[model samples]
Each structure stands twice: as structure tokens, then as C-alpha cells.
Target: MLPAMGDNVVVSTMELEKLLSMKGGKGEASYVNNSQAQAMHAKSMLHLLKETLDRVEVEASREMPFVVVDLGCSCGINTINVVDVMIKHIMKRYEGLGLDPPEFSAFFSDLPSNDFNTLFQLLPPMPNYGVSMEECLAAKNHRSYFAAGVPGSFYRRLFPARSINVFHSAFSLHWLSQVPEAVTEKRSSAYNKGRVFIHGANEITAIAYKKQFQTDLAAFLRSRSVEMKRGGSMFLVCLGRTSLDPTDQGGAGLLFGTHFQDAWDDLVLQGLISSEKRDSFNIPVYAPSLQDFKEVVEGDGSFAIHKLEVFKGGSPLVVDQPDNASQVGKALANTCRSVSGVLVDAHIGEDLSHELFLRVEHRATCHGKDLLEQLQFYHIVASLSFVQS
Candidate 1:
């Protein structure tokens, strides 16, 4: 069950560890949908990634082990692909300089509840759960690469000062540590009702979300600032909005929240959910405006915004099923449910999940499957270089 909401607390009350893990294995519960989308998003940023890596490689000491941190690296399927890209680029740069590449240590950090054992199983060894990084590396024809799982929230410190050389995060950081207090307050004018997220919210709801994002992002930058070395680079890709207003069609507006609202309203009509409960529960996710992100990073003063580009890419959730609306709806529903079911179940009840998503699929079909052909959400990719002084 979802925990009781807090009142007037400055600290986060959300159990981030419990809230964020991908479903273990390839079962229907698995976050393969999110991971696939994330991997594709990462692939789209390879050019920027390579550029940041090239810059990091120039200042890297050949003698010290090159460290790369993949923040919010959930089951390591997509994480491995991203790390592979970083390793490949580093190797090319070393070869160009007539020097052997430095030994690589890639740390996959996520919440403590993440399925690390399952992640480790996907390594070269067939079935060893207790194997060290050295054993895993030795088993495969490895390219001087080693892997370890560092379980922790990225919002807090995970490593010693100046420990990480390169930082990469995809499809993470939009999640707030907890729901903003103002929206949850009963007396406050910012109360957000009948929605899990603030996509089509009122002006007060938008301000509450933006304030929370600013605070959380400040903490994120500060933590990364401590971990990253001088002159190091960090690449971040997250869902963002082109328009400053939360209600604008350009940002997350209709693309995300409308579906949830549709399903919630359906449940309300069916008497499966109460209006009061619906009004109280809100999803702890935000798609910041591009300007919002730029100001936060620039204001932090720890990292220089090297490049910030907002692009729209294809969502992997929208599979090809033009002739079959049912199939298309199911595909989109399954993809979203894999990541959001737990939250929905927690807020409402486990029993309602099946019914809720059934309504969702029906709504999707009625809304036309063509809408799934292209995901109109924005992808804000930022390349940042840590300041020397």
C-alpha cells in the first residue's frame, strides 16, 4: 500500500528505493519497455556522448583507472549498452594517441532495491551470483572493462569527492524525490486534483512542481559536482517541455497526463475508485521546461552548460499494429503499466490494476492508435563540463 502523505515536511517522504526498481527478468512486469526506450534515447545522443567522452579523455590520466558512473542504471540491460559506447570511444581515443587505454571501471548506481543479482547474471559468466568484477572480466574476452553495482539514490552522494570522470544518465532525473508539498496540501491553493502527474495542471500546480524540480535539481547538481573531477563531462537526457506553461500542448500537456486522467475518470465512473483518493494521489514525476533546466544548471555554478538540445524522438512503446487497434492499445498500455503499475496499485489497490489498465487500453483504442505512431514528447539532452575552479 502507498504510505500516508506527509504534512509540512521539508525533507522527502517518498521511499525512492521501493518506488524505482524495474521488474526482475523478462516477465510481463519487467521494465523492458522503459529500458528499450532509454537505450534508443541514448543511441540518439551518441554523437554528443562521443564528444563529451573525447573531452574527458583529453584530461584523463593514463595511469589512473578511468571511472564512469551510470546514474539510475536500473537492470543494466540498457546500462551495459551505454557503458559499451563509452568504452568504445575511450579505446579509439587512446589508440589515436599511441597509448593503451586506461583500465575501465563502470559503476551502475541505482536505488538499494534494484535487482543487482539479476543484473550480474546477465554478465559473461553463465550463473555465478558471487563473482567479483575481476572474475566477470576474466571470463569474457573483455576489453579491460569491469562492472560493479553501486546501489544508492543519485540525489545524494554515492562516491567520494572527485571520484567520477564521466557521468551519464538517460530517462532519469525527472522523478522528484517526493510529491511536492504544496500540491498535496489540503488548504493550499496549489492542490492538484484528479491526476497522477502535473502535465495539464493549473498555474499553481505548475509552480509547485517547478519549485520541487528546482530544489531536487540543485541537489543533483551539487552531488554530482562533488563526485566529478575538474574538467570532467556529464551528459543527461530527460523528458522536457518546450513551452514554459504546464498546460501548453508543446510540453507534456496532453501527451502524458490526459491518458492517466482518462483511466482515472473511467474508474471513478465505474465506482472502483473514489474522487477523494484520486485528488490526493499525484505521481512524483516532472518534465521541466528547457529554460527551467538551463537556469538551474547555470545557477548552480559547478558545471558549464556545454550544449542543450531539445529534440522529439520516436517512442518504442508505439509498436506497429495499424490494422489492429486492440493490439496497438495493448502495446501502449503494457509499456506504460510496466513502469507505472506499482505506483497505481500502491495508490489505489492491487486488485484494481487489471481493471484500470483494461479501461486504459479501451480508451487508447477509442482515441485512435495513430496517436501512438509518433510520441510527441520532448527529449532535452544537456552536455555539461565541470568547472576547474
Candidate 2:
């Protein structure tokens, strides 16, 4: 079973809509997807992740197969994609060395809700892509076990002791299931509503979020340490924020979150809801910085650093730009899916339909590079090996 990381953080569609409507629906899926440009960016991340794997020194033999575990594996598509790249690189390395290549065992893990349907509706019965990847998946000595290690969180124990050679996590790890205790109602720290967003945030609140990130990250490292061997490999790519301020405005990440707040504030001014209704609402998007990421991974005493880079995943794939109207509309409908049926019946009407079009128009022009620039994310890839005491 997957571990349940965040048992407390809960944000309903109505709350998100409050954020979405505040951001002119730019917070919706297509807009958010555009902001991340993840699918396109993933191609570049594939290379960085591969390099991380290559950095691991393999002990040549059949006695011990390389073990690679992907935390926050989510449906396995990204995990599979990464392995494919790592394999191609390793094959090149093995060819250069003029030695019979070694074998590997892969562990794909994720939260229960991830769509594993994409994983392997069916795995290749034989080594179709016979090279580096085959060794990683179907090990020669029968360690290859295609498994669905579904759990609520990655905080649980799953792998064998000193078994992992490479570990990778993508676009996750910054978020925990709950807000920190310091941010709750008990202390009444001063909170200010964002200029446009219905949700409120403050430095104290940001500090609380930071605390949770540190705590959760420490736990993640402790678990990974048990599984990874000395000189193990690690790579983590994720959505991280540049600043603690929720309304930091501009830059890829801040502009995206802040613009949504603006859209939400419009709704509040229109009297569609009261400030009290907004009080309890917190759209949790506390992205940790790359510094936080380095601090956590390096501080954990698990592995030595190989390389960490932050580049725009500006691969040519998404440069053509999607039909802004179509994608934005799709994203809006997706956001609506998060709302309760009762609320949909009561709150949505002609106004929702009217605002939806305005959003589509804005997203259309904000396409490609400019949109991606709005989110300054780090494509962090670090190689780690368990520290040999």
C-alpha cells in the first residue's frame, strides 16, 4: 500500500474555482498545463535524469542487479520514459567499455489515484527493445517482478535494504497532505487576502508551509536512505516556487498563481461571496524553491551530488501552440468537475458561461515561451548514493 502523505490538506472545486475565477480561469487545467509545459519539458528532463543514472558506478557482475525505484511514480509513464532514456545512455556506456552489460530491477510506485492504466496494460512478453532497458526491467536472475506498488504516499517502506541504485521522482515531493500546525487557527497569525485572489497568505503562513515542506522532505529522505545503496543514483524534477509570497507576480510560477488570485478577487467584489466564505479557503500551491530541494537532498546524508541543472523544457514539441479556446474550455470544464453537484446547481449560471469566454481569449495570446517564462521552475536532477559509513 502507498503511504498517505497528506491527510489534512483539502481543497474542493469551489475553493479552486475561487482561485480559478480569481485567475480568470487561467488556473484551470490547460492554462496550468501551459504554465508548466510539462509534456514538452519532460523530453529535456529525460536527458538530465539519464545523466543522473549514468553517474552511478555499477559493480559489473550477475551477482547483484542494479535496483531503480521511482518515488511518486504516478501511473508509470514518466518512470517508464525515464528508464528508456537511462537504458539508451547505459547501453552507449556499456558498448564503450566492451563488457557484457549488467541487469537491473525497477520499482514503480505512486499514490493510489494515479492512472496506472497507462503503465503496461500489457508488458512485452519478451525483450522486444533488447538493450539497456531490458536489463533494468526483466532481470536475468528472476528479480524482475512487474508490480503495482500502490500506496497513498511514498513515506512508507517498500524496497529492500541497500537495494536501490537509482531513484527518481518527478513533479512531486513539495506538497504534503496537510498544512503545518503553525498556520492553523490556533495562533491567528496575520493573514492578508491576495490582491485579486480570494485566498489569503502571509509570511508567517509561508513560514508554516516551509516547515511542512522541510518535515515531509526529511521523512522522504529517511525512507529512501534505507533502500539506496552506497553510491546510489537520485534524480528529482518538480514544480517549485521562486518566492514565498503568494502574490509575487510575474516569472513563470508567480505570475501563474497570482493572476488566478486576481481573477478570484473580482468575484469577491461582485458580491457572489462574502469575505467570511473566503476566510477558510486556501488554495494550496506552496512550491519549494530549488534551494530548498538541494538543501533537502544534500542535507539528508544519503548520496553525493553529481549534477543539478535548471533549464527551460522549451523543447520544440509544444511551440506550435494549442488552440487556446479549445484547451482553455476543456480546462474550465475540468475545474468544474471538482465542484459538488449541489453547488453547481446553486452557483453556476449565465455568469459562469460569460466569464469562460474571456478566459479563453487571454490564454490564446499568452501562448508558448511567454507562458512558460511565467513559471521559473527548476528541472532538478541530482545523483545520490547512500553514504558509506
Candidate 3:
């Protein structure tokens, strides 16, 4: 039995501080550089988002602004695509109603440490793009799209009551607000040893991670419930598991973790990194099963689950050539590095970053592309609506 979470359990702020944000000046590797996998997921979620928007009751008054919020919008490229889809669909929906399309106020939100400047700078340079939000709204030609950044963690309230009409999140929400204290506590039964993450790990470690995810997600739903209008809609896309088993090693993230762990083990044998360092490090991410999601939404009672889907796919650039091991390896390596390199670097030290990824790439190559095809990447795209009384 792990020690209960309380004031005594030390939750490290330093652990959460290292999450990669697309910041720094030019030449720095932004989330944009490594977010191909994330972009693909966002693109896929567009259809679900449109479906939800179609059902949402819009006033469609030209004088009233239609507001949309992109929760956990890392950089702006993917958010821009999502917003563009929303705008296009919204315009069409209004046109279908024989009503003129209203102006838009799109809010791009993420953690405070997120690169808002980079996000704003990278905003779509469409006809309405302008010097400021005011200018963007003042445009006469094209759609009157106004975008701005709201920097905060979405696990808490960022907007006021009944403020937003549509909320969209992609490739986020798997991250807990903080690493579970049980995993970090030396004396706890849930003390995660040997492994950096829960990939079919011991029961205690898995429970600790799941509890954290549930608490964070419940908070997420509650906060959004307050901010969203009575009949507003949300489309969320996140990493999920097909099976209820937390120990399932079939998912791509877990499989990659296994390979990454092998590389770490090799490095440990070479005396390049201490086993203690590797054991202490864990990624604060949890891929909830569909059942887990249904439980939360049902319990919340604030949102009705309209549509839920789970499917498997891979990077579009990596075609289904199971014989091409090297090509597949490179594609997978690039995708992992982009998403997780920064987090790994922060934990294991940046000096070994290049060597570590090289080992990962080499390992992937050895594993062969056929292994990639067998690896299932479970993605959950959900459409939910506020349960109006």
C-alpha cells in the first residue's frame, strides 16, 4: 500500500517545470519542429470538432462575436489549422442558416511558460493577419479572425463563467499536473524503481499514476464546465489505451518507452549514466483507457459524451513499407525525439542527449519496420457537450 497523498508527500515543482514549450529566439528547436505527430492528431480531430459545431446552437448574429478556445495550444501551427477549420465550418453553418457569419475571437491557451511570442509570431499569415488583435478584427476583407494567447495551465480555470463557445485540446491532457508523489517517495510502496514510466509496471506504481490522471482530469472537466456556455461543445484528442490494462505494452508510447529503456540500460552498463538517475526519472504522462474516460465524464455529469472513438495510425510520411526497416526507424525516431527529447534531456542531462537518441534510432533500426506495423498507436477523439439543465 502506498502512502496516501497528503501534505507530507513531496510534490516537486521542479519536475513539472521542465516541460518543453516552443520558446527562445530563432534557430532554437520549437515544438513546431518536432510536433508532426501532434499535428496529425489535431488534423484528425477536425472532423469530430466540426460535427460537434454542427450540433451546437449558434446565435449567428453578425454583431455577436463567436468565441473559441484552444486549450493546451503548444505552438500556433496546429492551433492555426484547428482555428481555420472552426472558422470555415462556422461560416458554412451560419450560411446554411441564411445568417451572416459573425466575427471570431479565438483564444490560444497553454501554460504560462509556453512560447506566446513565438505562437503569436507564427499565427497564420492570412488576409486578416494584422499588427494587433484590434487590427485583425478591423479587417473588412476575408474573415474577421482575432487571435490572442491565454497563458495558464488548463487543469484550472483560465476563463470566466460561460465565456467560451467551443473548446478544443489535442495531444495534451495525458500529462498530469505533477508527477505522483508516491512514485517519488522512497518509503512508499508505490516507489517506482528501475523504470522511468509505468509501462506494465507493478500495481502500486500504476495505481499512483492513474490516480494522478483521474484527479487532474476531473479538475480539467470541472474547470471547463464552469467556463463553457450551457450548450457549448468541446472536442478533445489525447493519447489513450485500447485496453483497460495499464500494463499493456502494445501501445506505441509504451513500446517506444521499452526501446528507450533498453538504450538507458545500455548507457547504464557503459557507466555513462547512473542507474539511480534513470530510476528516479519518470515522465508525468498517463494514457487513459476509453473506459477510464467514460467513468470520468459520467461521474462529472456536466458534459454528455456524444461521440468517442479509438483508432490506430502512424505518421503520414511513413508509408506502410514493412520491409523498409531503416526508413521506418528514422521516421519513428524523429517523431519521438521531437516530442520527448527535451524532457529526456532535462532528466538525464543534455550532454548525453545526442548519444541517447542515436542509440534509440539504432535500436529502432534493429527492431525492423515490421515491428512498427505491429505497434498500435491508440488515439482517443471525443466530442462532448455541456449538459444544459
Which candidate comes out best when scored by lDDT?
1
Say which prediction, candidate 1 or candidate 3, comes out ahead on TM-score: 1
**TM-score per model over all chains:** 0.89, 0.68, 0.86
How would you order the candidates by TM-score, starting with the best? 1, 3, 2
Model 3 C-alpha lDDT per residue in residues 63-129, reported as the tens digit of each score: 7678899988876477877787787787677778888667778899987767678777877544633
Provide the overall lDDT of each model, using Cα atoms, as 2-decimal numbers: 0.73, 0.49, 0.72
- Model 2: how far is 12 from its true place, Å? 14
Give the residue spans of candidate 2 off by over 4 A: 1-36, 91-99, 122-147, 184-187, 190-200, 241-256, 262-277, 314-319, 322-376
Cα error, residue 3 of model 3, in Å, equals: 30
Model 3 TM? 0.86
Better of 2 and 3 by TM-score: 3
In model 3, the worst 10-residue window by lDDT is 1-10
The TM-score between candidate 1 and the true structure equals 0.89
State the TM-score for model 2.
0.68
Worst 10 residues of 1 by lDDT: 4-13
Q: In model 1, which residue pairs have backbone atoms overlapping below 3 Å?
A: 196-283
lDDT of 2 by residue, 2-50 (tens): 1211212234423322222101122332222232345456775666666
Displacement of residue 45 (Cα, Å) in model 3 is 4.1
> Which lDDT value does model 1 have at 183?
84
Candidate with best TM-score: 1
